[model samples]
Target: MVLLFAALSATTQAQVTATIAQAGFGDLRPSDGFLVQHLQHGPVSIGELADKLGITAQGVSKTVIEMERKGYVTRTASSGDQRRRLVELTSRGWEAIYASRRARAEVNRQLRASLGPGAPAFLDQIHHLAEATGAVTLLTERRLRP
Candidate 1:
């Protein structure tokens, strides 16, 4: 179990490193990716982003400010309520997301090639373990800590 945990942690770190390196988005952090992923469906408020990221609104605001400066996101007043601000991805933000997806897809392709015939079963087992351990629920709820 300890070895498995260590391996998972190491794999996750490697994947993140690879994705970030290949993303070509200067200064974009992993946490930023998580924040922006939530906005893929549509624009959301900072409070909503904080809720989804399981972080404080202040923290989300700090990150959002940086992202906005980087031209990845934009915050605008909501049409319904001028007092409320909605956050949405800019074209550059969407490009970053696509680049990260491509990087991950490449990583998965390599893993699948290495696993050969056993890849599907291995992936299924991993999914089963995640579900059994309730990791899937935590992931879906966006409650996992960075």
Candidate 2:
């Protein structure tokens, strides 16, 4: 019975994660939307983005290429290093960023409302997990949407 309950709990958690990822990310892949959100701050090198995202440069380049084709971002030569490519968000990209923020905010609001008095404790637990898992580093670099 205990093992069954544990399995059920894990399944429920996975479902919740998938639902949030689908609703919050919308049309773009989760990683792609995250990259767009990161670019909202300003331009960044592909290498820098890769490092921040904890992904490979080649992976970042592939996504950037797709985003570039979608007219969400532009790639230009870096001022200090012509060899480096800087990715900057376009107006469309900014729109995407805001849209993603709104979606995530709505989900978070609903989650908090459901948790009520437990929200703070729940968030604290999540923060601890993120830190223990090293996700805090990547999360801290991105702005938390209100």
TM-score of each: 0.86, 0.65
Most accurate candidate by lDDT: 1
Which ten residues in a row are the worst by lDDT in model 1? Answer: 17-26
Candidate 2, pairs of clashing residues: none
Which predicted model would earn the best TM-score?
1
Q: Which lDDT tens digits does candidate 2 get at residues 17-69?
A: 45644644334555576677668778999999887777899989999999898
Model 1, 1-146: lDDT tens digits are 86987896679657856676666775787667789878889899999988888789999999999999999999999999998889999999998888887777777788789999999998999899999999999888766667
List the global CA lDDT of all models: 0.84, 0.74
Q: Candidate 1 vs. truth: CA RMSD?
A: 2.0
Model 2 segments more than 4 A misplaced:
1-26, 124-138, 142-146
Candidate 1 structure, TM-score to reference: 0.86
